[model samples]
Target: MSDPQHSNGWRRFWHRGTWWKALLLVVGYWLVYQLIGLGTSALFHDVIDVADPLSSPASIFFGVALPILLSGLLLIVLAASLGWARGLFRRESLPGRRWMWLAVLLVLIPIVLRLIGTRWSAYAVATVLAILALGLCVGFAEELLTRGFVVNILRSGGYGERAVLVLSASYFAIMHAGNALQGQPLSTVLGTVVYTFGFGALMYLSLRVTGRLVWAILLHAATDPTTILATGGIDAHNAATAGTSGLIGVAGIFSFVYVAFALVAIFLVTNRTKVAPVAPATSD
Candidate 1:
């Protein structure tokens, strides 16, 4: 016979429901991320010699990579503890052909354009490796937390797919506000948030079409290093204050492209028709 104590524990757990679980997950991840950031700043303040934390390679490694790695691991552990690990990697069936192509275009076009127009530099091999590692960690942590965990939990909580997509994207975009604390100009930070909102939407559509996180993660990983290399590394102060007019112009153009693509993706995903069940054969 089942123990009454075990039964009571199970019942209490279910009583929390998906809404509470999602809220807890979001808040918990945010707190963990902030704590790591604070702790790292305290530990590394005297050790690192960089003037700006955002642009420094060592600072990026410690500030961005360490926190992201720890928070991401914690998120995964929490998800597993809550019995949601099995579905974390599950992919939906292939989306319609047109939507599939659109998804591909969404992921590829920006990356290709950025790669082509941006100039490559001759940074030391070690620096390049470190930047790549930073990119990988950012992609993995952000995607897992926002797209993987948050999206799945919301869906399970009876939220519509469209709502889930928008929510996840918005959250991803807003999280960039932390960049402001790193010394990026207010205008630059705002522009980035807008661009990222659109990027986040595209990532959502990519997951829907591919039914997996690998493509999303790869695209994300590629995007960061490409931007940094192309733009000549992360210079928050210069990007914000120096050549302000030119920066605004470039940001405007990029923002327009991102918003346009994001709208198209949203339309396609929302309007997609469900496959109808086939009628059974009738023997006369």
Candidate 2:
């Protein structure tokens, strides 16, 4: 017979549930993010004489890419160390419906066009590429930490699909609150919060429909650059200088459109007749 003490200990380690694990991941990611930001600022203070570190390729490399790369690497190490590799890297099939693919196309095609159309100086082109790289890292790190880690934990802890969806989405939205410190207006920040919450819900649905974290990561990486490009290219620095009312107006309109599409996608995915949960692998 198995030892009860050993069994309980194992359960405690693996079954810590959504709340605490999610909290820990959020706090940990924030700390890593902040530390990277501070360290990058110190390292590039002279190179990046301006207030914004995102204006040039060198600053973008150190300030955005380096930290995000480190954080992503750390998450990989932790995922392997904690025996979460299966959950973090699990794969699933796309949904059966054609509309889902249509929704994805709607979101993706325009963004790709905008990215291709955006004009940049030869030097600025390098910075734009760096920003795209940064977005890719952000997508991978954030998705792994949230949808891959937190969602799986919650699901394994016996949470239902709805509960899992809501919790994961809320956690993602809350995590973006740190953007406020970047000089975004309160109203614009709140608009982004709502927009991200809705976007998170769509991503949750995407995870359910597509059954792979890679799709989510790709979509997320694509989405970030789309936002930057749509709002007037990287050099605009809208968040830093756009006045409160103007920012609010722009954010509100953007959020409204995206949120509407997000809702429609969520509804389509969730209400499908043959939808089923894609359980994470049980092997450690």
Best by TM-score: 2
Give one digit per residue, the lDDT tens place, for model 2 in 104-219: 55556556555554433323568668778878988898888777777766765666656666778778888887778877788867866787877777677676667688888888
RMSD of each: 7.5, 5.2
lDDT of each: 0.64, 0.65
lDDT of 1 by residue, 128-158 (tens): 6766887788788888877777676665455
How many clashes (backbone N, Cα, C below 3 Å) per candidate? 0, 1
lDDT, residue 103, model 1: 53
What's the alpha carbon RMSD for model 2?
Answer: 5.2
Candidate 1 regions with alpha-carbon error over 4 angstroms: 1-24, 54-57, 93-97, 181-183, 235-254, 271-284
Displacement of the residue 54 alpha carbon in candidate 1, Å: 6.8
Name the best candidate (by lDDT). Answer: 2
Q: TM-scores for all candidates?
A: 0.76, 0.77
